[model samples]
Target: MEQLQVKLGEKAQITTVMQEVFATEVGAVYQCNKRNRLVVDFANAQIVLKVDAFLRLKKAVDSIDLRDMAVNTQRCSDYELLTVCGCEKLYVLTLPEIYSFKELLGGAKFALELNSMLHECLHTQVA
Candidate 1:
């Protein structure tokens, strides 16, 4: 029917438009406002996460103690396991990789916050 065709057309038009937020040698982060999602491409994995989930992921990564990870002799300390509250994927990263991941997430968070501040400033009334 024509209604079905129209629905399909609308769905097609809802394409993801992504903007690069940050990048590093190990990974890159992108934001898609249309979907309100952050796409993190890291270590051969592409993770699509909601904005809140991305924040939680950043918090989790930031909580890791690099010094402890580096100094511990336990076999389990060889790799850090990270899991965000709402995200289903589990990330296992070695010390160096964890450091890179932390940097990537931190940079992305800063870029997104900066963009939000710019938008607010640009749109504010000149009162």
Candidate 2:
């Protein structure tokens, strides 16, 4: 079987979108700083996010679509990295991150719901 490898750059784009949406809704100023420096040579890999960047990413993911994650997506296993070779970059939600802030602020619920829909649409590109 071929390895499942996701491009670091694609993942970064998803993270960036999530971060922007979360920041806009929560009034939080979040910025995605490039933690891993990638190169054209896909074989030579040295890409990894620092602790702070990881935390920010986690928060952004959490804030994206908590409701859908709880009711709809499958939870991703606890792995430092997800490699999806032969498959393009995609957003896989883990359950715990899905239903965070069960009781949301005004308009926040809609934001999360929209994020969920957006995520599903993004997944369709892989096929």
Candidate 3:
């Protein structure tokens, strides 16, 4: 995964993240007196999704517990497969290269931080 860049200002902060696997640009533009919005720029369209939508999605993903899940890691050809189960649904991810579990955990933590920041931005705007 590529690194996510966050810029904090006096009134608002911006987060810029790129999905290297796909043609997408996901960002959050936080400002005062307005709802914090999530901007998703695709190859052909620019979409502004409400931050609440992301919050809901984040809640669902955050509910997942790795401790209760079964993990199967294997290498097939040039890619690696990470299968996680034991939740309501099964998840299979194909990673182009091998990555440490710590790295994945760190990514999840970063996501949670991002969600918290977004939530706080919205709360500040509303208050």
Candidate 4:
């Protein structure tokens, strides 16, 4: 658990504990082990997702063809719509926003995989 102190008033303060999985200039992903949830903060919005839902969100984001979407002249192609299984919020993003979002997700995915690998290697008992 990580503790952070925030000042709300002269006599008010608060603290929050979270493990940051990944982050970019535009957003970040945080893991709350105690709650078994991932908190995604992006585009001025925050979403709480379970592990499976986070994976699904990454898959959905990866499937989008940014190049095609950018080159296409269709009006609908100007923006992309994204939704993750078990998540209620719909993400409507423009080309640049999509790029940033993709970057954030990709970084988070890499971090998660690296953590898993490290955990496995550290816990394995070599005979």
How do the residues 25-63 of candidate 4 rate in per-residue lDDT, one tens digit apiece?
Answer: 999888776667777888878777888898898888888
TM-score of each: 0.84, 0.21, 0.27, 0.84
lDDT of 4: 0.81
Model 3: CA > 4 A from native: 1-36, 40-48, 71-127
To one decimal, what is the Cα RMSD in angstroms of model 3 from the true structure?
Answer: 12.2
Q: What lDDT does candidate 4 reach at residue 21?
A: 91
* C-alpha root-mean-square deviation, each candidate: 7.2, 15.6, 12.2, 5.2
Clashes of 3: 0
Off by over 4 Å in 1: 1-15, 125-127
Please give the distance, in angstroms, between residue 67's alpha carbon in candidate 1 and its true position after superposition: 0.3
Give candidate 2's error at residue 7 in angstroms: 14
Q: What is the C-alpha lDDT of each candidate?
A: 0.81, 0.34, 0.37, 0.81
For candidate 2, the clash count comes to: 7
Worst 10 residues of 1 by lDDT: 1-10
Measured with C-alpha atoms, the lDDT of residue 110 in candidate 4 is: 91
